[model samples]
Structure formats: C-alpha cells, structure tokens
Target: MTATESARPGKRGGTGRGTGTGAEAPRLAGVPLLGSLLDLTSDSLGTYLRARGEHGDVVRITAGPPGLRTELHCVFSAEGVQQVLASQAANFRKDNAVYQEVRDSFGNGLLTSQDEDYLRQRRLVQPLFTKRRVDGYAGAVAAETASTLAGWDRAPDGVVDVSDAMMELALRAVARILFGTDVDTTVDVVDRCFPVITRYVLRRGYSPANFPRSWPTPGNRRAAAALDELYGVCDEIIARRRRDLAATGATGATGSGTDTDTGATTAAAAGTAPGAVTAPGAAPGEDLLSLLAAATSADDAEFDDTELREQVLIFLLAGHETTATSLSFSLHLLARHPELQDRARAEIAAVLGGRTPGAADLDRLPYLTQVLKEAMRLYPAAPVMGRRSVDAAEIDGHAVPAGADVILAPWVTHRHPRYWPDPERFDPDRFTPEAEAARPRYAWFPFGGGPRACIGQHFSMLESVIALAMILREYTFEAVDTEIAVSAGITLTTTGPARCRIRRVDA
Candidate 1:
C-alpha cells in the first residue's frame, strides 16, 4: 500500500481543498513575498504564541519566497500533538530540511537517522541507557557536579555565568561517563569545539540562504576546524581504548550472540589481555566507551572506527548539551522566584543533612524533580520538534498533505491554557502525582514521546537532579538580570550569558 493510503485507511474526509471541513485552521496572512518568514525569524516563540492564541489549535503559517512558498502547520493541542507524535507517527518521519542539515554535521547518528537505519541504531544504543546503566553513572555525575562547584566556591565576586558553568560541568560529567579515563583532555576538546560547530549548524539551518559547508566562508572554515579537532580527539580516544582492551585480553569479551550489559550480542569484542595498562582513576565497566569497544554485532562483525566515533560523538553532544540547557533554565527560574528557591534548598538540606547526594537520594528529592519538570515545561530544552508527513494524515479532523512540514511545539503546547491553567506561572505543583494524573500525556512532553522519543531521558533527569541538589546544598542563587532573553536554536538558550549571583551557605 502507498504511504498516503496507509495513513488514511478508513474514510475520505474534508473538501480536497487546502482547508478541511469543521472549523478550518486559520492561516496567518503575511507580506506579499516574504510571507511569515520575517515574523518567524524575528521571534519564533512570540510568533507561535500569537498564532496559537488567535487561530486556535491548528494554525497554518506560510513562509519562504513567492514561487517557492513553504507552508507549515503548527499543531498546539494535546490531541493534535498526540496524533503527530504518537498515534500516526509512522506516517511522519524526520525528513525535515533542518534535520537533514543537522545530519551533515552529526552523520547518520540516532538524532538524524530515519526508518530502518534509525530503528537499527536505536536498538544498538538502547541498552546503554537502560535505567540500570543510567543509575550506574550517577556517582560520576555527582562527583563532576561537586568538582565544578568547588571552583565556584572561590569566586572573588560570587558571580558566574550559570549557562557557561552548567555547560562546562555537564561536558565534564558526560566525558567521564562516556570515556572514563583521561577525560579532562576529552572534555577540553569538546568544550572548545562544540560551541563553534553548534552555532554554525544553527545559523545555517535558520538562514534562508543555501550556503554549503564547502563554501570555505569564514564561518564554514571555523566550523570545519572545530569539527576536525573534535573528530581527531574522538579518534585518539577510540584508538587508545582499543589498545588498552587488546592489552588486557578483554577483546571479544562478549563473543558472538552473547547478551551483555548493553543487552546486545557482539561478534568480536575488543578484549584486553591480562596485565593491561590501566589509568589511575579508571574503574571497570564504568565508561560507555569501554562497553561499546567490547561489543560487536550478532553476526560477528566488529564496528568500524567511524561507527565508534559517531556513537561517541552523539552521546557526548546530546548527553550534555540538552541537560545543560535545562539546568540553566531551571536555575534561572529558581533564582527569579525566591520562595521556590528556598523551598528547594530546604528540601536538599532535609534530604542530605550534610552529605552529597547519590542516585538513591534522587527519589527522595521529589520537590527538586518537580521544579525541574516545571522549568522544562516552561522552557523546554528543545522548544520544537519538527517532522515531515510521509503520507496524507488527519490531525484533529484537519487534512495534512503528504510532505508537509508538521511542527509539534512543546513551548506552545506546554503553555496552552486548555491543558495548563495559568501556564506562564512557575508552579511545580502542576507535576504532582494527582495533578499530573489530571492532565493528558502529551500535554507536557519535554523529551518527546513515541518510539522515537529520547532514549537518554533517564540519564538527563538523573544528572539534572544530582547537579541541582549539589548546587542547592552549598549555594543560594539569585538572578542578576531582571528578565531573561530566551533564544531558540538547536536547543533553547539565552541571547546573552545567564549570569547569577551566588552566595555560599554554611555546610
């Protein structure tokens, strides 16, 4: 069966025209040629908010130039979001141009891959993020959080850029969790290169001009240099791990068709011989790289160096960047509301007494989790999730033609008054067990849903919880700026550095 036929199995509805029957989705009229492009470019969040407020759940927005006009249908209701992300998800795929642009930099990693390749890659990496595996990394996360905060202890003015600091902390933590030994070097490389590459990618994705990366423009050159440095570091790490494994005779540790911690069968694992050289602080089975290195497919085929590098890079980038952004926004929110900050701090003190938090402590700190959830709802790390319809589908009785770009915006839906009353207010109680049970599932999907949802969500939540607990234990944060300027890119960020004043508390 064809994609469109499969998408709409039951009955043919709607007038075959662009607009459907029952309450046609209002289209935002724009300029003669530029259309809604200018409005979208200026302030996407504002534009989405206005469109949803004025036009209801489904709002049709037109952009691009005259002949090549691009139309996007923004779905901003729980029911509609469910249709796009869950019910009829198979009818939609990550064929968006923006996603394709991202693939150029990230390769065919999980975030960018689609169809059979995506499913295969997802299965390969799924084992690494199981709850058990994620819990195992909590100690590393807490340690990194404490170590990063130690530097803040000696700040002369008690002022630091929360965004940059969180990014640095998250980068170090992810490097250790993913690489294990000599992580400082890896973290340094990623920290230096990630910003340049991400900024370039976002710029290229957002700009209307089709500037190829090979153009050798100044921005492209810098991005290329950064990527080369990043890849070089990854190559070095992979080679070093393989050498270590070989020396220890741990190569092929999980032979063909054997179930390992990652729950996948490997053909020729990177084994290490006895008396292998081990780094001073390295612990067995702690790093993801070690696990991946010692793994092969069920068919007895070892992963190539390129494949290894891609997996490592994807984990390093996605593992840290989104968590850092979420933490930054969470901290900003708490700083703005002193009552919530005090409550969180009190909860931390009551829970830990005097010691640092561990994975076990995460469950006990419910308030901290609530705060994080609310913050994510208000300013999701990924403000929008874009998908292109592979077949003609009906969302809330509206016809979505094949190949149309369908946008499911958490930023808008999370704040939609229909689902969340007083949505703009920062109320952690909204996530309480009873309160959450009262709302729809797709109403607040910060990490997304369905089979394609983020696999590392458990890891992200654990890391955020531990980091927030550690910070709240020792320092009281206050916002420096009256208002934060939210900027939307690959991830949500601030226009300027999110600066906050920190006051050290008695231990």
Candidate 2:
C-alpha cells in the first residue's frame, strides 16, 4: 500500500500487517529454489509486470541469494517515482555493487562516484551545459553532421544499418566536441576495445569475482590494452597542446600550432584545429577537455591530469553509447512508421528550410523532439537505477534494512500502461507538451533523475536532434524488414543488427 494511505495509527500491535488494498496479501512460495534467480536474470521486466498485476504497485518478490530478501518496488507510479527520486533522494545512493560491475573499467568518474566527490565534480562540470556554453557547441554538432552525411551512399535500394550509422555519427560528434580530435580516426583506436567493454558491462554472466584475470580472454586483454592506449593518446594530446601554448606564451592552455606571418598551417592532420580555433561566430574555442582542465572546485578541489583523463573517458564511454542507442532506436521506429517518418522529415525541412540546423531550429522541431523522446522512453539505455539505503528506514511502510538495494526502473515506468497509453507501441505523439503534461515528472526519465542525473543530457539531446535532422534531410529511409528483433544487452539494440534501405532525397 502507498505510504500516505497507511499513515493512520494502527489499532493492532506492531502496526497493521494487513494490506491497505482490499486485495489478498501476496504469499511467498516456499518451493522454487531458482525462481528469484531466474526472475532477476531473464525477463526482469515481465516478472515485475506480473508481480505488480498480481499484488499492487509496491509488491515485494524473492530476490538475491536464496532467503536474502530484497525490496523490489515498482516506482513507475508517478507519485512513487517522485518520492524515490526527489522527496527522499538523500536517502538513496547509487547501487554500488551493480555500478561497480559496470564502472570498474572507466574508473569512478561522475557516473559511479557518490557523496562529496560526486557533488564537487558535478559542480565543476555543470557550467559546461549552461546556455552560453552549450550554444557554443551547436556549430560543431552541425559541422559534424554535415560532414558525416557527405560520405553516405544512397544508391537505389541501397541498405544501411541505421544503428551502425548512428554509432559512427555520435561517437565522432562527441569525440570532436569533447576531446578536440577527429573521431573517425580515433574510432578504430577506441572501438578495438568497445566490444569487450560492452561485454563486461552488460553480459549477464559478468561477475568480476569468478572471472580470473589470468585467463587470456581476448576481449578482456584487448580492453586493458585499449585503456593503456587511450591514456597514452590523452597524455600525448595534452602535452602537445601544453607545449604549443607555452611556445606562444599563452596564459592558459591555448593553441599555438599556427604561424601568424603567412597563416601557414603547422599541424598537418585534417580537421585538427590550428593550435587554437573558434566556433563559427565565437571569439575562442573551449572544448570539454579544456573546460575541465580550467575548472577549480569551490573548496579548492582540482582535477589533475589523471582525474581529467578518467572523466573524459567516462564521457566517451557513457555519453557516446547512450546517445547512439537513442538515435538508433528512434531511426528504427521512423523506418517502421512511414507516416511518422514523413512527419518528422517535414518538421525538420519546415523548421530548417535547407539551411543547417541551429540551436533555434531545435526549439522549432517539436515533432522531431517528440520522436526522440518516445524512442528513448521505449528503449532507455540505463533502464534501471538503484540506490542502497545507508541507514535503516521505512519505504512506503516497508522496513528496508540499511544494506538493502532500492531500485527505480525507467523501463518498467515507461511501459506502465497506467501512465503510457499503448505502452509497447511506437507512438511519438504521446510526447507532445500537452500529452507529457498529463504524465508525472519522473515517468519519462531517460537520463535518470535526482542529483545524479546524467550530466551530458543537454549535449546528448542536442547531438541526437542535429544528427537526426541531418540524416533525414539527406536520405529517405524505409525498413527493409520489420521483423528484425531488438534485444537488450548493455544498450537496447537490435538482437542482431538494425538494417534499413536509404535513398538520397532531392533538395
């Protein structure tokens, strides 16, 4: 029963055990040794749905090592999500064991850190998403999209894997803006370790305990090797920039890779900035790396080079993968629904009018925005968010022991029929401002909620819109086959691969 409904003093001893709801109380079966394990591992959403249906919204099921009870509440209810995220947020902490399982490779950047460290880092990094700062990123987003589109082959009946296409676009966009490097060149450098990282993070059997480091699993070894290479690359770039800036006598980490006399280029790599660069109309450039390097915490906390690399690596891994999944799934939906695709394309064309999309265009492209929102609702990359109670407390009148894990799942919430109409269908209109207003605040969270909300949210959303607009403006896509099944691993992606046919559209 909801906490509010059961707040009255109970006449009986030790508070009432009776369910506030008129329905019979759920009974835990003594049999089925593997029931909870199977439920936790496979088809977790389905299991939650059934439990909610059988009992009420806040049903408890047997989970974890046998007899080790854990509270599995369905906060899909708007009120439930709010209470969990905002009302009692301080009571929650990111589920460490689960996050550690995923974040061990990336190190404790924003995504995995908690308490004072997380807050300090968040404060240092928050300004980068400010209107003035994000506005600066628009030109880069557009340039990357336009350049990526120029290389597309749209032959008659030519098929392209939209998912793969988006992966390429997002990785490159993030790389250029965040690290100031041509991502296309670095994709090979980083992607060599991508599969292994993904496997370790998402694989059901991924337990750090049993998996011996001695074993030469190629992916694991590759991932370790890749980390070394990534660190080396980051160090090299920092040293080069530091050297150039010193040569020019620049106060901060500014660029000096150019000759003022002849406007002669010194750095030969294509797309690399000449010592320093500026945005299309801005005075000077400040990429994510530079900004992080420049930031100083309120308490005088400063990030050294190692900390900087850790956060940047976190940005690369978390930011790129999630945005790619969102775009990929949205494209898959667009291909399936021709009417929706046409509507999105028309919206983009009308708003952009053949000129490149700008920050202003984002505000105008409501339909495109809705399409992305709905797509992310259906396929939230980080579907489940959890926290462990530091001290023993009652949650919705249930005694949640201090060590217990409290989970709030966006996947189940987005698909909760009570809130989402036709929960499983690909319906973009549901995300209209009017429609969204009818739902609860936490009902549609894709970047999660509370103090720990994904820091790269604005960046990701901006990237998705620009990328989609660019692709739709240049190509008309159709689902070559609608039967392709999508499965969830680390990210909600096609079980096999996302295949689509594209033809260049006439401007």
Q: Please write out the lDDT profile of model 1 over residues 306-359, one tens digit for every residue.
A: 877877877776777689887888898899999999999999888877665655
CA lDDT of every candidate: 0.74, 0.62
For model 2, the stretches where C-alpha displacement exceeds 4 angstroms are 1-31, 63-74, 154-157, 182-185, 203-222, 241-285, 396-399
Give per-model TM-scores.
Answer: 0.88, 0.82
Q: What is the lDDT of residue 166 in candidate 2?
A: 80
lDDT of 2 by residue, 275-366 (tens): 22223312122456655665554464557777777787777777777888888888888999989999999888777666666555667789
Least accurate 10 contiguous residues by lDDT in model 1: 1-10
Record all residue pairs in model 2 with backbone atoms less than 3 Å apart, i.e. clashing: 255-275, 257-275
Give candidate 1 regions above 4 Å deviation: 1-24, 251-281, 299-302
RMSD of 1: 7.1
**Model 2, position 223: C-alpha lDDT score:** 62
Q: Each candidate's root-mean-square deviation in Å?
A: 7.1, 8.4
